[model samples]
Target: MMRAILPTRALVPIAGLWRVTACMAGAALFLSACGATTGGPGVTPGPASPVVGAPPEPAVLGVEMSPERLAFTPPHLEGMDLVRVGVLLPFSGASAALRSEAGHLLRAAELALFERGIENVVLLPKDTEGTARGAEAAAEAAIADGADMIIGPLLAAEVRAVSGPARRSNIPVISFSTDTSVAGGGVYLLSFPPEEEVRRVVSYTAALGADRFAIVAPATPYGQLVSQAYRSAAAEFGGTVTAEEVYSGGVDSMSQAARRLARAGIGSLEVGRALAMTGEDWRPTDSGAFQVVMLPAGGDDLRMLAPSMLFADIDPLLVKFVGTGLWRNPDSAREPALANGWFAGPDAEMRARFETAYEIAFSEQPSRLAGLGYDAASLAVVMAASEGGIDRAVIEDPNGFLGVDGLFRLRADGTVERGLALYTIRRGQFEVLDPAPVRFGPDSMAVDVEPGES
Candidate 1:
């Protein structure tokens, strides 16, 4: 198959999440895990055939990928008899695949390393049972066993649980969790976080020429956080959110909620629920749909909103439809009532890979939860090869943009900042409407709020 996108010198910074089309470099990119070669002891990865089209396994020598700028500067693993690495995943949780996938990640990482002849590392696997307390115990066990570093504790709570111990022991824990708040001086999150999505949405919408915006939000924690990020990122692009509407509705009163938005000349749950019963005309402004609509809930309401936006021909292009990462699937674009539009979330590449890997490994594609497993494991390998004795260039540089599910950078705080690509449902496919990892520098006016500031 394919080789690491080729070891490069340094990344060439790209501008705007939506403006990039390709990764061009000789000094800064390794687009694949194939073509990998090593000169030391390496762990052989297990079978990893994609259900659809996963790139064939790479040559095995036990070499792993290094983060940008930093490299897999082999931290004395070569002639050291055996290098002990820990694997912490939930084996008995509701989602069995997450736990099992840890093994797959180990396989993948080991294969990536095997080709490099770096075979001295041994994985000390443990189960977190999918809880914070469980993760804490597993992490302690790994450290007690002289594990060089730990990977996993997929859940955010678990990431938080294990961080304290990792910090105390200086045994770097590369987490698959995305709770950016869990980040500390020692814990590292490899999962793409919400911040990257925020950056991607704002930068892309600006590139699409959206000058004004608004958000339709819910009064929940997740809803409020995304809304705030959307609002802030929108401002970074010279755009203004003129309105923010909220709904904390139940099924019994869903219609009444829709009616309220109708009265305000805004699309509301009140009006949406009553569109048919009372024959209330659902009207969008002649200027088109509000510049943007940030929908926060899922499971059912989206089916209702789709038709409303359609019959109104709200011009999704005129009014970009912003949705939570929860809305990244066929249902959002299906129902025959909705129009092709834009949204931000787990994005396309993730959709493509997870679907195939899940089926091959477990006869099913993973849901959002499964994503955490993949993110955590992939990130752990990256972090292990970087800051905590496993120096790799890809995970150490500020200018690097990893194109797995999203782009990310190892911030000084031991947490990662994600950079997701933007997608628009075009024709029948989710097209990469906006390329990601828009480089923001000291000069860029992006606001730098402290992590966990909320």
Candidate 2:
């Protein structure tokens, strides 16, 4: 199940259906092209089998891709002074199921080098098979091959396994896992975290005079993370949590929770209308308790919960709705109640541009995670060509790099900080409410005026 095409030099191997073809671009440049195939492995026939060729899972903050759009190409470098880059990915064993997705990631990295025409860099892709042991073996093999840097091992467990080896060798590893626990010790996490999203959006809303906040989250691990993030962000951003509620993933639990939260600012009449079955008389409060309510859910869950809040006598116009990166979906924008709601996420325009370029060059669509490969490789190329190649100071630039998603920088603790923009849900779309800051500072430019300023 492997194929190789050697034009002038042996290029990297890509799994799945791809045909290698090359055409000379210039005297010093050559383009090794590959034809993309949309048809994937057919579903196994059995009672337990899922519907054959069902649509793939919905991608975050991006359009759903059809099989008709899948394509790929392997990049080959041509030069004397080679900057060896070790790429650790799950290419075999149990993780072999993800080979198709991994192919797209590798293609993205190749596209970065091809676009930059970085002839001096050579990519060595190793198979981790998506396990801790596999990751360890891959790292050892990569180090033995003299890789100057490592750029993958997608899962947090895999990253953890490679961290010790990578640190011991003094070879910096930039991982794709979002789990911050695995970060540090020469391994950088490039994946987006919910806590960071909460910090950014909550801070933006708090700066807008929202002194009080409330959170309604599911009783799940992710919900707990968002809950903690809201608490921490509210304190840091000059706000307080007026009320917090966690509910099981259902309408009844959420409705009950909403009723309790609505009681914070509900009048006697509104209370009776919303909770007539309570059989207990209620009176009005200050009505100025919480200025904003955050729901860290998305898709159908959000669509249902938003209306439940309205049904619970909480006026959307009075208390603004705030959400996390989950609200960046196209479906969420269509919710009438979500209009004017704010959330923090990547720059959609730039991300769209990258997707378009990817589709055109590879004749295929890319997954959301593909952006990491491109960004990581781009960072390596820039650093490799700099005065001190891959210098710690250079990679950890405080000013950050302008990526496809927007501005981002690596921290000393191996955590990534992105300059994410605040977006407002509009009618069937999302509008940029506050442009992301270019750098980390109080004086950074904001698209809108400061809170309470006319």
Each prediction's whole-model lDDT (CA): 0.51, 0.67
> Candidate 2 clashing pairs?
71-364
Tens digits of per-residue lDDT, candidate 1, 1-454, equal 1111111222221121001111111101231233423111112232222123223221112223222211122232334545456667665556757645654554434322332223344455466767788777766666664566676777789888888877887767777776778876667776656655665666665775665666656677776777778778878888777666666765423334434433434333334544443211222233532556665555577666544444444434335566655556676666443344556665455345444434443334455445444444344344444444544333445653333354445666766765566666655556665665434354433322111100
Q: How close is each model in CA RMSD to the real structure?
A: 12.7, 12.9
What TM-score does each of the candidates earn?
0.65, 0.76
Which runs in model 1 stand beyond 4 Å of their true positions?
1-82, 94-118, 249-259, 262-289, 308-318, 345-388, 391-396, 401-403, 437-454
- Model 2 TM-score, all chains together: 0.76
What is the Cα-based lDDT of residue 143 in candidate 1? 65
Residue 313 in model 1: lDDT: 40
Could you say which candidate leads in lDDT?
2
Error of 2 at 2 (Å): 42
- Segments in model 2 whose C-alpha atoms lie over 4 Å from true places: 1-79, 93-97, 265-286, 441-454
TM-score of 1: 0.65
Candidate 2 per-residue C-alpha lDDT over 293-327 given as tens digits, one digit per residue, 9 for 90 to 100: 89999988899888888889776656778898989
